[model samples]
Target: MDQVKTYRTNVRIGNWNEDLRLEEDAKNEYLEKKQRGELAAQKVEVLKQNMLRPVDLTASSDGRLHFGDVVMLVNMGGENRARSTVSINADINSLNKTPSPAIQAPCGISAGQCVDACTRTAFIITSIDGSPEGSTLHFEQSFALRTTSGFAMGLYLSSDLQSFQKCSKKSRLQEVNLDDKCSFLTWWKILHFDPQERLEYEGQPVPANEDVVIIHCKTNHALAALGDQVLWTTYGKEYEVTAHTFLDSHKAEKDTNHWMLCTAENRLELLNQSQSTADNQEPTEANPGI
Candidate 1:
C-alpha cells in the first residue's frame, strides 16, 4: 500500500476583516450614546414641575434680605396703591438693578398690586443675596383683576424707550457702458467707423472698407463685419469694433489724444502715430479735416 501524505495550512486574517469588525464596534457605541442623550433630556423635562418663589427674611450677618422675608413695596412711577399682598420667592432674587423686569411669571403681576393699603407692598423674603447690594428685596404681588396694559417692572419705566423708523426707498443706480461703439478696424492698430442707416468707415473710403476683416497671424482665421461687431478667435484673441462711442468730434478728439493700444497676447506694443503727417491725417470736426 502507498503511504498517503497530508499537509496542514494555517490561515491568516486579512486587513478587510479587521476593518469590518472595528466599524461594527463604532456603530454600536454611537447608538448607546444617542440613547443616553435622550434619557437625559427626559429627566430635565421632569424637573421643570417646581417653580421658584422669593423669601422676605433679611440675612442675619449682612443687612441683605433672606430668601423668605415679607415686606412692603411701592411704585415710584405712579402713586398707585396695590390691592394684593406680595410674596418673596426665588424669582425676585434673579432680578437685575434695572427696574424693568423682563422675566415672565406664570401669573402676571401689576403695578397697582405691587403696593399695599399704607402704600407699602408686603413681600416675603426669598433670597438672602437677592442682589449685589445684598440688602435688596425681590417681591411679587398677585390679584384677581387683570389690567388691559401689562404691568411694567424694574428700571424699564425710568429708561428711554426706542421708536421704530420707516426706511427710505432705495434709488436705482445707472449702469455705465465702457465698451459700446459702431465700427472699427485692427491693422497692427485699431481704427473705428461710425454707425448710420448704412455701415461706413470713419476715415477711410467706404469702397475700401473691406467689411472690417480680422485675420489671425498664425492660424489665418478670418472674421468680418459690416458695422460695430465683436469677434472671438479660437486662439483666445478678442476683436471689438468702435469699442467706445463718442457724442461728437470733440469727445473723439480727446480720446485719441489719450488713446492707448494693448495686445491681447502676452506682449503689449504701442502703435506709433508719430510717423503720420498732417496731410495724411483724417478730417474731423475738432481737427478741422485731418
Candidate 2:
C-alpha cells in the first residue's frame, strides 16, 4: 500500500531531479490520465501484485498453508496409482472431448470439462473475505480453492441436490468463476484428522498442511479422487475427482478422502496469478453458514 502511494505521488510530482519532470506542454496529459482513473488503476494493480507475493513461505517450505498460497492438492492415502494432486485439463490441445457427454454438473460453467488430479496443475487457495491478499489460513476457516486460470473449486446441486452431490457420478469436482458469490458449492472448509483436536486448537495455526479432509461447505461431503474413474488428458491418464461421502456406518472415510494442500515448492516454475481481467469485480463475502 505504501509502495503504491509512493509510486502515485512520484508520478504526480516528479520525485527525480527537475530534468525528469514532465515538460509544461505535457502536464495536461498527466492530469487527464490521472482523472480518467488510469493512474489509479495502475497503482491498484501494483498493490495487488505486491501484497499477493509471499513475504516468505511456511518455514518448512511444504507445510503451514496460507491463504493465497499456490499449492498442489496431493492425494496421499487414496487408491491412486501414483502420488498426485488436483488439476484441470483446459484441453488446449484437441486431445479430448466430453468423456461423459450426457452428464452435467451445476457448476455454472462447462460441466463436462475435464478436471483430473495430477501433480502438475497448480491451485491458489483464497477467500473473498478481503484478507490482505495472502494471510495465514486457519483450520476450519471457510475458503475457496481455485486454479490460476480463475476457476474456483466448487460444486453445484440442482433441485434433487443429493442426486448430483455424490462422487459416483457426474464428477462434481467442478470449477466456477471466482467472483462475488456466496454459494456453498464454492466455499470449502478443512478439518484436521482429529476433529476433537481441531477444536482443541481452534484459532492456533493449523499444524502442517497434512492429514486433512476438505469438505464442501454446503453438502458437508468430502472432495474425493476416484482413482478408478480415470480419464485421458494431455497429461495422459489422471484420476477423476468428485464430492463424496461414505453412506454406510460400516464404511468409514478412507484415504481417498484424505488430502494435503501440499506445497508447490517442487513446481519447476512458480505459477503466477493471472492478471485481473475485465471480469474482476468487488468480491462479496461468502460467510453465510460458515
Candidate 3:
C-alpha cells in the first residue's frame, strides 16, 4: 500500500486583518532573512570567479609546454597590451541599458560596471588521459585548461541546446569538473600551421614558442584572434577573440589563429621572439614544477 502524506501551509488564511498583525510581521522578517542569505551566497560566488587566484608557474625551461603546467595563452596576433593574453570576460551589465559581456564583447558607459578582460590570467593544463607530468603537449591527445577557481572553459551553447552560436563561435568559463560530460567544452587540441609541416610533425610534441592553432574538442572550430573585428573592452581596444569555423562554407580563419603558451617567467613575444631563461619566469608560489 502507498501512504499519502499532506502538510498544512496556509492554515490561518481565513483571518483577515486591516492592520499589520504580529504573525504577518514575523513572516515578512523571515522572508527578508531568507533573501539576505541568498544574496550572501551569490556574493560569495562572485568573489570566487572575480578574485585573482594564486597560481604558480609550472612550465619548465626545456623550451616546451608540458602536460601539467600553469601557462598563459598569449595571442601572437598583436603586440598591444590589450591583446596581450586571454582572460575572463564575465562582466554583467547594470540597469543603465548597458550590454552584458558575459560571453561577448563588453559595452557600457561607466568603466566601473566592467570587469578586467586582461588580468594576467593563467590556466592549468591537464591531459584527458592521465598523461604524466614533464610529458610534452601533443595534438593527437585531448587536453583541458582550467582556472584556479574551477571554471572550465567551454564553448557557448544556447539554452535549448538545439542551436549553435552563429558566425562567432564564442566560449565561456563554466564551473565543472573534468570528469563531467559537460567538461567536453574545456577539452581542446593544438595544431601547427602549414599542412605539409603539420603532417611531417604529426604526433610530435608541440613547442611552446611556436605559432599554433587551438581547436575546440567538441565543435572542431579553431580559436582565432580577429584583428579586423577588434572590440573596445574594459581594458582597452582588444583584438576580437572567437572560435571561427565554417564561415559561409569557407574554412576557419588562418591569419589570427596563431597563439603561444607563454610562461610568466619566460615571456615569448611573437614580434620580438624573446626566449628568456626560465630562471626569471619561475614562480614564487608553492606549486612545484613538473
lDDT measured at residue 39 in model 3 versus the true structure, 0 to 100: 44
Candidate 2 per-residue lDDT over residues 1-290, each given as its tens digit: 34444355336454555655557537877888777544645544433332233322223352577776766665653444445456543332211114411112233211111213221244567775676555777777877775543122232221113544432333544322223334555777777755547677665655444667777777777776666666664445666666765433545567777776656443322222112321354555763321
Q: Who wins the TM-score comparison?
A: 3
Model 3 bad stretches (over 4 Å): 1-55, 78-82, 92-120, 150-182, 230-236, 245-253, 268-290
For all candidates in order, the CA lDDT equals 0.24, 0.50, 0.50
lDDT of 1 by residue, 1-290 (tens): 98776643554456978998899998988778566533444323322212222222222343222333222322112112111221112132222223432222222122222221111123222221223332322211111111112121211100011113311111111111111111111111123322241223333321211122212222222211111222222112222211122234433222211111111110111012223444577878888862
Off by over 4 Å in 2: 1-63, 92-120, 149-182, 247-252, 264-290
> Which regions of candidate 1 are displaced past 4 Å?
1-54, 59-72, 75-109, 112-158, 162-290
Q: Return the TM-score for candidate 2, rounded to 2 decimals.
A: 0.52
TM-score of 3: 0.54
Tell me model 1's lDDT, rounded to 2 decimals.
0.24
Q: What is the lDDT of candidate 2?
A: 0.50
Worst 10 residues of 1 by lDDT: 262-271
lDDT of 3 by residue, 1-290 (tens): 88776656754445456335877898898788667543444544443444344455554687777877777676644433223555543433311111321222121110111112222256667777778976888865678765443332322211111144323322331111122232566578887765457777778887775677777776666665555544564434654455654232244345456666766454433323432323345665684544
TM-score head-to-head 2 vs 3, winner: 3
